[model samples]
Target: MTEFALDAPVLVRPYTARRDGDFAVIGDDSRQVYLSIPAEGLDLLEWLRDGATVGEAVRRFEATHAASPDADAFLQALADEGFLAPAGAHDPPPDAEPARARRAGHLEWLSPHAARRLLSRPVLAVCGVVVGVAVAMAVDRPGLVPGPSSLMFHSHFWAYLLVVLGIAVIGVWLHELAHVVGARAAGTSARMTVGNQMYAIVAQTDLSGMWMASKRERFVAVLVGPLVDVIGAALLFITLWLNDVGVLGLPEPVRLVVAGVLFTSFIRLLWQTFLFLRTDFYYLITTALDTRSLMADTGAFLRNLVRRVLRRRLIDQSGVGRGEMRTIRIYAVVWVLGRVVALAVLFTATIPLLWFYLVRVVGFFRGDEMTGQFTWADVLALAMLSFLLDGGGTLMWLRSLRRSSRLRRRAPDRVLVE
Candidate 1:
């Protein structure tokens, strides 16, 4: 394991200022630190860089300045956040060169191909229409076919549930496929990874080569999945309409399957488009802002700000240019504010839904009611599965956020500014 030391000198880099009074540091490995501070806080950073230890820095400041005497605590805090990793720990790891070499020739699966042939555009369009008609028929003719008898229910419910779950899984796979296809159409190479225990898969396209491409191409890549989703929904809707009108004559089970597939696919597409969830919308925002790593950089800035505030030391102002600083300040404010709002919304809405589900599960366990209308065994199974799915998704999102943050912190200044 790599361990950072505590006694290394603080590495002070060049400085720049933002319109909103935030400071930026340009350092080795192209790291940029955005410092939010009051006017007088700037001098404190300069004093510390002049070879002052946490205790000595504080004593020197107290000799003249009137801030709190918690400078030692503050310096320790910075050291923890990697902003001031102990001096000798800065070298690259021994395995880094080997890892780079191994990764150099990796082949990405989602490379550009003749997608128009593989997808069979006409078949997709027609099948989409058929699925829509089936859904319409099911909704309009509800209970036209009787519910399963008690014996049939006990015998076949498990099987039916498995089929439904299987369809759901397929919907997710198709969702990812759409992304891969879109990236390929945009002439980017992508690879899919079964991340975090097979619950979530990510289709990552190597668009580094396309950075110089026109904005239209970039936007097209982002828009592809959502557009395919819309097409699927419309087709499903049409199929439902046709079935209701007695034109397609689809069976009841087929209709329900179509409806379920359509509903799940459409919702997943909508979820991915939600900007707050940091889905495809998040990527779109980053591309539009021309900042490859805004959220990560903003998070780093906030972490640094919190460190300085805890230490009661002056904030550092240095390194970034004026326009870059302004952009970062705006991004930091928005990121902090958005997270607060997101937490509030999740608490108010998501928590209630979760509580309701829990109540149903408990009721089933007590045999008071047929919670979720599932057997106790099935209920336990579903609960465990859902817990794994939801929890895994959340963890993956958080990890991605952290990885993106670290990448931003270590990225070239040009990448951030662009």
Candidate 2:
């Protein structure tokens, strides 16, 4: 990118702007790249687009806005982003290539507008119907949901587990797809790819464009993934009810397997409610409240509190805007409460169950014959469960600790600008 003199005028390439709540979403329509800008920034862009020199635009912006604009930095940023062209550059090519994500590669297979027009209303209706049916079934049956005893080691225990695992894999793939579908239904571009989340490799649906969407659209986009699981769970529960009430007689093994799968769906739905983890419901809440960065800002507020308690230099919090400050504080309390509940469950329930199974397996291996309802299959199941639960998590914590130490040494408690 060549540097431009303040006196030299540059052409502001054609773009589109739409109001998104408090901010404005500006997009280089030809490139399909979008960015959110403050009102003052939009004004500055308009001034530049109207043939004002950088210096003159800055003067005009300062006259209307309180702060003096950083004309040089702003212009350079625009030039780098391919939004500006030299005085007579013939508009540079209309499709000069939008900025792309380098991390997880993706392909947008569906046209957002087309998909929204086709699926939004119908899908929403289906979701509503499913929820209503699920509630009615639950009310009638009263004991429809599966329990731990629902899992039984029959003759085909391994086969059942393998099949259930396959269903779980399909469910996860559908989860990511649901996000893409939902985003498209809300008229936002979305793409799918594999990515890391909290050290686990998983499928990700990139909904970066949702920032420009309406609040209702954003809420729908976030709710759809969990709604997918909800619908699945509802259908499964209905099946269970039919089987139990003799309306449809399924084989005992078949019924058990369906129950197991239904249980998986229920767990996935429950996990979505863990807002501290930034699950679907968490995104919905943030969108509803119009918070800029709920999780990140809340964590920052908590970190600043700790620093204050320690009488140490606080992290820079200037990036958190006035509108977001109150939300962040409220979210901080919720975050803390959620963490406490999670830790308590982990220690009191999950750890104890894991320990019981692990101890039984270990004792059997140490010259103690398996007894007390424990079998070889039990050992295998417990071992696999432990591997799934603790395998990468412990290692991730160690790696994170090491990275945190290094970051602290380089810049202790510095708040990063996101």
On residues 1-29, what C-alpha lDDT tens digit does candidate 2 reach at each position? 45666786778888777776457767664
The 0-to-1 C-alpha lDDT of every candidate, in the order given, reads: 0.52, 0.71
Candidate 1 versus the native: TM-score? 0.53
RMSD per candidate (Å) reads: 12.4, 5.5
- So what's the TM-score on candidate 2? 0.76
- Candidate 1, 1-418: lDDT as tens digits: 2342334455544443322224222222223223333333445556556765545555566777676554444444344333343344564343221111112212345445664344556755775676566466557765432232311334345555556567767655565566566556555444444554112334333333334334665676666666666666656656666676788999977776566556666566656754533466777876676554565456556666776777744324343446656777877766667667766755675455456657767777677756445666665655655555554555776786676567655542213322
Which residue ranges in model 1 land beyond 4 Å of their true spot?
A: 1-165, 185-187, 196-214, 311-334, 341-372, 394-418
Global lDDT of model 1: 0.52
**Which predicted model would earn the best TM-score?**
2
